[model samples]
Target: MKEVILALITGFIVGLVFAGFKLPIPAPPAFAGVAGIIGIYLGFKVMAWAGPMFAEFFK
Candidate 1:
């Protein structure tokens, strides 16, 4: 929860700065960005779930 709040605050500030400078925000469009993040998180979780099983199998 703390990390989520901090990330929101930082993103808001960076957004404001980018808009003030009239530059593009350095990220994908909203839905794509969220989907990408979700994909990355899922990938990490999948690896974590499989890692122990693979290690035991290879032993």
Candidate 2:
């Protein structure tokens, strides 16, 4: 929870700084981009879950 709050605050500050400079916010501007991020996260989770199983197989 603390990390999440920190990320939110950091993102908010970056968004403001970008806007102040009249630049685009460095965030996904479309649903597709958001979905791609989600997919990457899910893939990482799956790999972590499978890691121990694969390790045992080789031993």
Candidate 3:
């Protein structure tokens, strides 16, 4: 998607800037940390998808 591409590009640029300045990258440095972030995103998306169904059921 266009948004995905844009995000990748932006991240790449920021990474380059950080590397150029010899600064630490502003993100998780390990796979487990990255997986945690993915898990959080998935949790949020799953809740968003299920919320309406639950609301309808309750009503």
How accurate locally, in lDDT, is each candidate?
A: 0.90, 0.91, 0.95
**Per-residue lDDT of 1-59 in model 3, one digit per residue for the tens?**
99999999999999999999999999998999999999999998998999887886766
Candidate 1, residue 35: CA error in Å? 0.1
The 10-residue segment of model 1 with minimum total lDDT is 50-59
Q: Which candidate achieves the best TM-score against the true structure?
A: 3
| TM-score per candidate | 0.78, 0.76, 0.83
Candidate 2 vs candidate 3, lDDT winner = 3
Candidate 2 Cα misplacement greater than 4 A, ranges: 54-59
Model 1 ranges off by over 4 Å: 56-59
Model 1 over residues 1-59: C-alpha lDDT tens digits?
A: 99999999999999999999999987776898889999999998997989887886767
Between 2 and 3, whose TM-score is larger? Answer: 3
Writing each residue's lDDT as its tens digit, candidate 2 over 4-45 gives: 999999999999999999998698989999899999999989
Ranking by TM-score: 3, 1, 2
Distance (Å) between predicted and true CA of 56, model 2?
9.4
Q: How many residue pairs clash in each candidate?
A: 0, 0, 0
Query: What lDDT would candidate 2 get against the real structure?
Result: 0.91
Superposed by TM-score, candidate 1 places the C-alpha of residue 31 at a distance from the truth, in angstroms, of 1.1
Residue 36's C-alpha lDDT in candidate 2? 99
RMSD of every prediction? 2.4, 2.6, 2.6
Ranking by lDDT: 3, 2, 1
